[model samples]
Target chain A: MGRGMKRWMLWLPLAVFALLFAVVAAGLFRPADRTVRSAMIGKPIPNFTLPGMVPGKPGLATATLTAGRPHLVNVFASWCVPCIAEAPQLMRLKAMGVPIEGIAIRDTREDLLGFLRRNGDPYERIGDDQRSAVQVALGSSGVPESFVVDGAGTIVLQHVGDIRAEDVDDIAAAVRNAK
Target chain B: MAALCIALAAPVLADPSTPPAALAYTQLRDPAQEATAKALMETLRCLVCQGQSIADSDASLAGDMRSLVRERIAKGENPASIRAWLIQRYGDYVTYDPPLSAVTWPLWLAPIVLLAVGALLARQSFRRRPR
Candidate 1:
């Protein structure tokens, strides 16, 4: 082949690789604010009325959980390390008389039960969300998300990631102050 | 050529036995820095996974990227500066965060620019030819 043609052919693969790299990299580094906001702050709570995991009862509707008063809804998974880290904080909230509910997303009943048993059940009501439908509806980015719902069923506050003790207090205060 | 193909595909066929790498190389005590690092990792694409963050990825390279972040922080570099340095060395692809600057204008405006160009090209191409 001619020198110029050979040079062009060599550059073609480099050009293609560069294009692929740029496109993939851009997708990977896309702004995370919209996702983080929806997952952690702004999105409404999931509309699920799943059967309760507690031994005696059938299921607790999402409405039932949020029916009478403002409550704290926590989304946790058996596999999430952050959920394990925040177990004590959940327990503390329960001890302090916060009406905390839970949605166990993408976990089996046995695993959920084991997690609760191992970590200590801090939830008054627990929902089995093995399919993650509830989690998707609630716009959870990952496990260990907490939402404060008002008596009227509006989500007042959402906390992404592990809930620290101070977060619990802030959420509780928000729930109390929610009109 | 046969030997070259085997060499190229060896890593792909090899058993992936490497341990999952941690996100940070050095321990960070500052809550703000930690939060920034966590957010950056989640946004930054793992070169191996392409779709997942270095934080969420189990790839050896992702671990290296995490460790790099930690090492930079340990050297007293701020998160913004560290991110800038990474972008400088690795291009904007290294970060999930795209800097709002001239170099990244095309990234921010690509969709609109492409749409406009397509419309213009279509109009020109479809313009009435002499019958």
Candidate 2:
């Protein structure tokens, strides 16, 4: 009887390992949404003092977020391809008198200007986030994320990924809600 | 067959180049704070790679998080407050050691449950065996 118990006990470690493996594999196969839920969603916008992309242009600061009306704060990078894909939508937003603030994440001034020049600059003020600190503080998942901030500087909504044609309505509505 | 394998693997290897992975081991200014930083890193999940903690991952986001941990430790921020700040920004999913809530109760209980079941099975086998 002792021998039988001992043999079964030997397989216990293997069984546990297999079970753990299965659980881990299941998590891997059908993983949760790639977007890590942002804790900054319901909170106020994080404070930052990023410089302008150019010498004379105004930089983006925390105070600028509370400007009299609600606006969209767009985090972008010259290196991010999605930013290019969403350029036209941003342009459309700009055309509709929507104030678009830009954060150039981890990008050089020359590259940022070049990207803006090529993609049609819709930004009223663009901040150069050389270290990507401000972007991360805003709980942005990656480039092309946009936040709708009300006059009180509260973050109304965060839109992750490139804004598609279908996303314009939701984004505009969020902007309106923030107002 | 060899050509086919090479052709199949080419696209997988060909990805847009980005900045090199930051893996420099910055000397911890304080040895006492080092332990706390290590513990925090182990607890914090890599935001980019959800599968591994910052301690175990070499992803860029993990590297950035490690740097952030060290930076905060250098500035005299305690581990608990730093973790709390990250949790506030990134949510509870940012930590491996989450609260014992309904969402995590099963994960926390699984090992104990497995152990109990294993012991019961072993005992049953023992009782069924004849001398």
Q: Name the lDDT value of residue A41 in candidate 2.
A: 74
Best by TM-score: 2
DockQ of each model vs. true complex: 0.02, 0.28
Give the Å shift of residue B129 in candidate 2: 3.0
Query: Model 2, B1-131: lDDT tens per residue?
Result: 99888878844211113452332146476778777788888998887778898888865456667877888887899988988888888878888889788788999899999999899978887888957
* Model 1 agreement with the true structure over A139-169: per-residue lDDT tens digits: 4445678878877677778787898867877
Question: On residues B1-131, what C-alpha lDDT tens digit does candidate 1 reach at each position?
Answer: 99998888844221123233343344467777676677666777665566788888765456666766665665677778867655543456657778777888888899999899899867766784533
lDDT of 2 by residue, A1-179 (tens): 47998899789989989999999999999986778757797688888888887666788998988766888999888878888999999999888778899998767777777877899888888898765677668876566789989978998888888899999888887888787
Give the runs in model 2 whose Cα sits over 4 Å from its true position. Answer: A1-31, B1-25, B55-60
Chain A alone, model 1, TM-score?
0.73
What is the lDDT, from 0 to 100, of the residue B6 in candidate 1?
86
Among these predicted structures, which one has the highest DockQ?
Answer: 2
